[model samples]
Target: MSIAELQLPPSALHGKKRVLTSAFVGTTVEWYDFYLYGTAAALIFNTQFFPAGSDVAGTLGAFATFAVGFLARPAGGIIAGHLGDRIGRKSLLVVSLITMGAASTAIGLLPNYATIGVFAVIGLVLLRLLQGLACGAEWGGSALLSVEHAPSRLRGFFGSFTQVGSAAGMLLATGSFAVAQALTTDEQFQAFGWRLPFLASAVLVVVGIYIRLGVEDAPAFRKLKVENRIAKAPVWEVLRYHKRALLVTIGLRLAQPALFAILAIYLINYLAARRDDTTSGVTAVLIGSAVGLASGPLWGWASDKWGRRNIALVAIAGIGLFIWPFFWFLDNGPLALLPIAMLLGMNILHDAIYGPQAAWFAEQFPVHVRYTGVSLGCQIGTVLSGGLTPVIAASLLLAGNNTPWLICAYISGLAVLSFIAALAAKDPVGDRLRDSDAHDEFEVAP
Candidate 1:
């Protein structure tokens, strides 16, 4: 049961296509459920779930509930990471999928504020928390499953499938909303059309659950079990011994998630106020996410060719430089510029960083504690950035008379921080991942 005795046979690695499909499909479903709430919050929840109030107040209330899911994410990551590191990744994936599906479907069925008073809002928040937890648990397991099951040299390319799932999920969410809007009038959409997307998650979840169950656990985890090297207290070990890796993971994670929040969530409200139509913004985002779906694996393949840090640094720099022009296109340019701005910001810039993120973050830790390290770091960073970006950007917009300069500066600052973090982290792509043992002290490569 020693590490050297457990060299993975070719047959053990043969099911990579199945593993990648499982990861991509399952993560897509999870993110679809999670992001549906964000879209709904932007388009309908403000009025549907909260008391009658100013437009800004209602947006803040709905976004506040959206943020609640993020707050619950870290707890989910911690719990799932701990158990996933000990037990297995497949089971956690299945459980998180079911949890998110149930929560989203319930949201579809729940009564509105006008019908049930404050109880409606409370129910919304509670269901959002469940969605958050499910989302938190989903990424680490899915990413690791794909990365660990693939050949080491192709880990970056294969791992990007999970990132593609995110883009696909956003596309699905935006497309679903767009179709619902197209089919229903404004009055009809507000009344019932918004619920269709949430309710539809039930069917996707069944598919995701079945696919996930068919896939085996990662080869690395299986090796860990054969060797009996699983860490007894993975969370505590990550906190005590792997603080720098955790910090690096969090730092590298900041700008991308924040950028995504701005593009995917805040922009909907921002553009709606200007055009007086929400569909335009949703259409723009849908187009951007579609491009993003194609770009993710390309960037990931580029990372495998170049280095993860090299591609990440270039992408982060692109984000910093693109912030000003992004708003310029949105604010001063013609209506057609909206989709172009989204394309440059989301598909090109944000996705370049996200494409290699799964492999890069997983590389930061050894197998025994990787689940906890990557999940905790990723979820914490997400909570700090993605969870708050929309609310903060909305406040900045309102305070600055709908100006975007403050928001631009905010994103630029995060990009700068992330660039420094990526520069500092080591690229261990040429190193053998399995050789990094559980007994060794956590040492980030120089």
Candidate 2:
């Protein structure tokens, strides 16, 4: 289908701004809930959930729990994608937020390792997995919900609201943790301050659900449903027909998860190892990371003006080159590093591309199978790129090369590769929303 042939509703109900707001708020709540777990895992879970061991061993154990959530993401994506395609985007979004909020709250209330022994660890892992699953399904629905409502020319910008939500969520999560830490003594923070953030998510979830329920489903999905065009097996169909898009999505996501993992999660560990600084240092870095969240929507807007490929290439290159230097500055001292760490931690360069990325990938698939295609592709990419980067970075540090320059270069290389992949990809902005038969007719034209 061609751009001229692309059909959209003329009704006021399909207004671009309204859809974007829905997507943005929903995604923000989901991500805020998701990132809170990462923050807690980095700071509190090692002591609270995992058994006593060497600091390294305990940290690894915490990270192991972190990884467990990622393992559940693909499954969540598959299930959420199927439900999204089959039922409706709006309902699934509500479920996603509720699921994420409940799991996070439960984690907050869970018994500590001392009280429950191995059971605490088991409970933490299960909750983390639930968070991952909820997020896995959450993004695709949110992204498509916006993109389907947008004009083709503005899809990139509109779809980017999803990333904006992500940035906001991360900022809020880190900032909340920082504020909570500041309000309480270190002993109090480890004992219960962290739980406050988790419990607070209950309020965000309710707000998100109310906002999402007010928004209508996308016209694209609605049209498909009207025609009974939704795929019976979206996962199998996406894998069979859109394999390249899936692979490309994975390759493109290579930089995002790796960079975020390093800066937000791994950096805390890195700093803790270097000086065993007070919570002030950790809070400083997290606040800096929150500052990084501002980049998402701005970058998304920029991508809409320029090309997605151009903006992504520039961001990737900037991140790759700048991260090495940022790490050098960070290594100088936390004082010297605070600003630099903030610069890098917030993913200033990376967010520009990342902000528009969900829409970029989601636009590649047709409406009928869009959720599955987007969720599966993103999860696969996230697992391969992000899920293991923290472990790798930790291992590298343990091997006596804890230099920022080295880790930056490694992450930057992944960014560079993903940028190259973006260069080779097709721009899906003006493409028609695919009908059911389009998948069967799909072919890779060399």
Candidate 3:
């Protein structure tokens, strides 16, 4: 409830800090692995791996891989969520980091269409799915680890790091690519430069494992284990007992991921389609992403102070209001840097809402089923909002109509729905974290 109340008496800060560090650093690396693939998709995958008869076909193929990750996310979430609840959050985080890093490393070494024929495409898809699965599990574990260890008053600020890591990872991914592009000739860069980022993941993975090993389980979870309150089937129980929370999680995710995909991944493609060269487009996005790295944490900090629901409501309203203007700046081309900066800033606003989301989501469930509920809710968000929105946006754009306002409206509308959901949610503030038996559910915190 208050900072002093949750301080762990200073004696426990040493252990708690270790967990927080692990969560933040591990998530940063995990995101780096995932975002590296996104950079490749936007810049080089079509030409290197999924070359088609034409540019459009090539672009479609690239996006197909990007979307593949989204589609596979739910399965990953379900499996990893169950494992996290049953075992420990730290173990799942380790597995996810290794899996994502290995998959990403493999992507760096993958033979292209030229070297391996169609297998290149197949191999890439498999690897992408692995990344997706790993990513799906990564969020729940990281958020819980941080929040569980955090002072209750600071849950929003610390919880924000998980998402902050996401933005930082994207920034790292994009920035690395941009640097690579600058150093190499177009010929050489396309020939091999893309692989550097993927290969670098191995180092990050090793570091994540090392850090996770040193961290202890959350105090809440430890108490649950001591009390014999672990759920029998967290996944099933979550579905059977907390259907309402699940639905709310799904709806909230739609706005966050869809808007994110539109602005971050799809915007580059959209810009490229509008202009012959996309160097400027990529640069604008890179700047925006760098800004996100900072904004995400700031948003998380705000959420902790003001309440997750209140912050989310404001952010959703802001993004809905800003969508048309953001696109208008892009339509006006590279000259609209100030407006574009503001557009990118709008996402930061979203991040403020999104930063505390994991803790907010997890707070709804008992410790035993927390992973399943949070993971399922997030994955559904990924599938519906994150995974599909880019494809949908692409289709909308291709229909000879470019009305960003409509897209903005759709994103804002979902946010409004989530706002209502938030308004109705039982707030968990001031409650000590509790464990649940298979049939034992916490009173939905309000």
Candidate 4:
């Protein structure tokens, strides 16, 4: 081989690292901004800004605000996909980071129910919607930045970094809440300590934007541009041609967000309602998230070797079997077992699906419209699962007098549905995404 060819491989490998790291940090910032609200909503928002009535009503209100973010995610995804496909991934990622961080910081500054009454609630909902839109745009861009920049052989390993950001962000958000709680009395925490986590997102956003600005668009996207392969209305193109793949992606995605909502967000409320506290659940989740953050890349690497379909299928099944055991550990715990169940739920069972999702989802569409196709499908799933999950779990608990069996069944049903969808969808392991036949036929708009 020529010396030029030898030099080419190492240079390309180094570039992939730069792109993947930018994607990782930017995604981490977005998720940190997003998950902080989930924690705040569960821990304090209901009492702070919502229409006050009962604890249940307040929680429902807080979570309804949470759902509003998910409601706006599709629009964000559609807009980002359109722009990112034509303009570039790096720019949109920076825009998304700033937008998400600013919204979160504004939430930290907003007045609450005691000061402004219903206007406080309205402001909170609007900010939450803004957060949703920014986040919806963020997920696909960051994930694609990593996956598209990566070599096909290592796409899962590289793509996994975006998933790592999710777990890391959850870890950061949960750990911050734990620290804030420890530093303050319950009343002080409820009054003002909660804002610290939201405020911290500004620092993350700054770092994310700096890093993202240093990177270029992925190789595939650049190639698409060079070939004049950009789609004019990519969302409509996906809807007309690749709708089945989009639907399957949505179905497979439902379980992960629902599981996260139940175990991460709802469990805080569950523990609070059951024992009048969230500290243990927070502690367990903090530990679980840290473990998952570390393990995501390993799972991503494994997906490259083991196949995304096989790994997802097994993990979903594992999640089903572990559901009752998970709650049992929380319910009958000697306290030490609490983290074990959470570790299994978040790090092991959940990461199996999440770690490879970036590569898996990206592979479903062609380079010309990949961002729009993947973003639309994944954000729709988020709206369905993440938005309403805590509300559904909370309602079930209220109906069953706090019995968790019914709630567990609801989550298990989603897992089963997810498994079936994965079974039906094609695995794109080593599939050259740039060569998608489905998109090759569509001519670029004039």
Candidate 5:
């Protein structure tokens, strides 16, 4: 069908810009909440929450809590996907934002290990789990909200607003930490300055919720409701009938999330361990995320022009080729080169995949189960890669005598997996506007 033929009613399309803005703002807030924990885990969680060990052991302990959030994500994805598929995307987006903001703000109020003993650690883990669940639920709904509301030809560009939110979140996250560090003495920063970012999430969440409430659900979903075509068991339907779509989505997702966890989270501590300075790493990430915020939409536009799978393959290849040099710049190059490494690794390579991913994954499943399928696939990949990569990389660093060769090899292996999966994916942008119930199964490569 031609793009014009598939356009929704003028009323349904009237809020397209508003929907995109809400998706971006909601996700930015959600990610800001999520990344706050990661930045803290890297910089101070060990001393504040798990204070009883040697530096390496304490770092490991802190990262384990970081991974705990990943462990809860699939549950969040499953619940959100099921409810989103049955109810509507807008409501879930709103709920995820509220839950994330509350959990993050609560973390700011949590007592430290010295003050409350092991309960402080226990409380931190519980709140982190909530953050993970909220994050898990947030992405699919946000992505679909943008893609489904967009005209077929502009889906990539619109869907990219969701990805851009992640970059923006990271930028806000790193910037908040940098500013906090600058404003406080080391002892004061360790004691109280770290809580400021988490507390700030409360304000952002209110803004996000207001914007989301003002917008309507996607027209595609409204049509599904009008026609009574919502899936009775979306999670089951996806698992039983769309296994290939699930596999392909997971595969295509592996590299970027893992690479991001490494560069944005783990590397902060790694660089700090080497130079005893966290500021430079945070600054590099801040610059890289700014670059990513600009690059994300362009990459999404490229996917619209060039094809999603093709752009994804090129990005996967770039990650594979750049892993070694990314580390080289951090380890051997001058201080000036740190931001360049972050820019190339994060904005250039990672955003290339992330920008195209929402529309591509959404296209892989029928709308009836799009939320469930994308959430399950994407979150599973996250748990396996991004969630665990920091812990695994840390262990490997210790084993390799602090060399990054093992981590480099690990990321390269995932890149190859993603490339093969991207090759198997069928670009279905042309058919995205089709009626969801008419095509219940994905059109996969034979």
Candidate 6:
């Protein structure tokens, strides 16, 4: 069959911009909710939500709640991916948005440890788990929504809309908190000011849901339905048939999330608690995230030229080599210049991996189980590297006598693994949208 046969019909592709917009807006809200918690875990949760303890122990405890979300990510991917693969991507996307918004709003309203004691921590953990689940489910659906609607030649570029949204959400999360912190005294900020960002998620969620409700499911999923090719158990099918691809996807995803955990989340706490600087990197993180927003599409465009793996390898290698130097600039800089280092290290270098990631993973699996495959692989990878990174970084910093060497080495090591995974994984750059075993199941009937 001609490759053109797999393409979205021209009329469907006519809505391409809307598809990208929908993907971008929905993720902005979802990630805003998710990232807000991570920012809070670093800045507020340790101080406000948990019981009194030493700095490291308290930070670790707060991060434990952060990790809860990562732990639950795989389950989110499994359930949402199954439903997305079977029913439609649009439905799962909407539900995940609502789930995330509700969780973020609840966390904003929850009493701190001072008010409710142990139950507050328990409430926080449960809500964090919901956020994690929603995040795990949201990425794959938004990615597929954009990539599946894109022209074959520009799939990488279009897939980047999701990453752009992710960056926007991070910017919003950091910037919002920065504003709140700037506006309040430290005492007042700790007392109640931190809740504003979480509560703000409710408004963003309403906008996101209204936007997403107007979107149609990706054409690929619709085609699957018409051909009756949807897998009855997509999660199982992905594990059974695509194990190697799944493993590669997980490894390929590790470096970026781990980098952010260190640069954005861990560093926030590390600087604030260890260096007595709470506001040092927040602006830099926001700036870096903004850079990521502009450059994500550029990397996606590069992937279209050079292939996804090629672009990813360059990024991974860049981050690995730059880690020590990056931290040196960050550690020694005056408060005014630290974000510049972050801007170069994070927005420019790390984004190389993130830019092409969604399309790269989507093309690795066929339509039938693509959502499950991509979501499960990413969630698994995140739980391993992204989720535990803050805890690990905190321990390493303390173990290494408050130096960045151990943390730099840790991130560099993950980058090496990422490079190896990219080298070993197949690059399906020119393949039709995907390859699915469901084709076999359909051959007898379609």
Instruction: Give each model a TM-score.
Output: 0.93, 0.88, 0.90, 0.92, 0.93, 0.92
Give the winner by lDDT: 5
Alpha-carbon local distance difference test for all models: 0.85, 0.75, 0.75, 0.83, 0.87, 0.84
- Judged by whole-model lDDT over C-alpha atoms, candidate 2 comes out at 0.75
In terms of lDDT, model 6 sits at 0.84
RMSD of each: 5.3, 5.6, 4.5, 4.5, 4.5, 4.9
lDDT per residue for candidate 6 within 1-446, as digits (tens), equals 21254343455456576788898899999988999989999888887877587867788899888999999999999999999989999999999999999999999999999998999999999999999889989999999998888776677778888988988999999999999988999899988899999999889998999888888986667877988888999888888988988999999878888987888887787777656887777877888888887788777766765678777888889888887886676567577878777876777777888888888888778888888999998899998899999988888878888887998899899999889989977666622225422222211212
Q: Which of candidates 2 and 3 reaches a greater TM-score?
A: 3
Clashing pairs in 1: none
Off by over 4 Å in 2: 1-14, 278-294, 333-337, 344-347, 401-406, 428-446
Worst 10 residues of 2 by lDDT: 437-446
Candidate 3 structure quality by residue, lDDT tens digits, 1-446: 23254333555354466776787789889988887877688789989987769877787788878889988888888998898888889888888999999999999999899898999999999999999999999988888888777766566666766777877777778788888888899899989988988888898889889988998778778777777777778899989998988887776776677777777777777777765555765666667666766676666666655566767777766666666676777677455464355445445656766777867887677777888888998888878777877666666665546555556666677667766766765455422223222331332221
Look at candidate 4 and give me any clashing residue pairs: none
Greater-TM-score candidate between 3 and 6 = 6
Error of 5 at 42 (Å): 0.8
What is candidate 5's lDDT per residue for 1-446, written digit by digit as tens? 22244343555346476887898899999999999989999999989988897988889989999999998998999999999999999899889999999999999999999999999989999999999999999999999988888776667878889999998999999899888989999999998999999999999999999999988877778888888888889999999998999999999888999999988998899889986777778888888889887788888877876678767888899998898887777787786778877887887889889998898899888888999989998999999899999999999988888898999999999999999888887686533434333432332111
Candidate 1 residues 362-412, lDDT tens each?
888988998899999999989888898898888887777778888988888
Task: Tell me the tens digit of each residue's lDDT in model 2 across 27-135.
Answer: 8888888888777777888778765768778888888778777778888889999999899888888898899999988987988989988888888888898999998
Superior by lDDT: candidate 3 or candidate 6: 6
Each candidate's number of clashing pairs is 0, 1, 5, 0, 0, 0
Clashing pairs in 2: 292-346
Can you tell me which runs of candidate 6 are displaced by over 4 Å? 1-13, 430-446
How far off is residue 175 in model 2, in Å?
A: 1.7
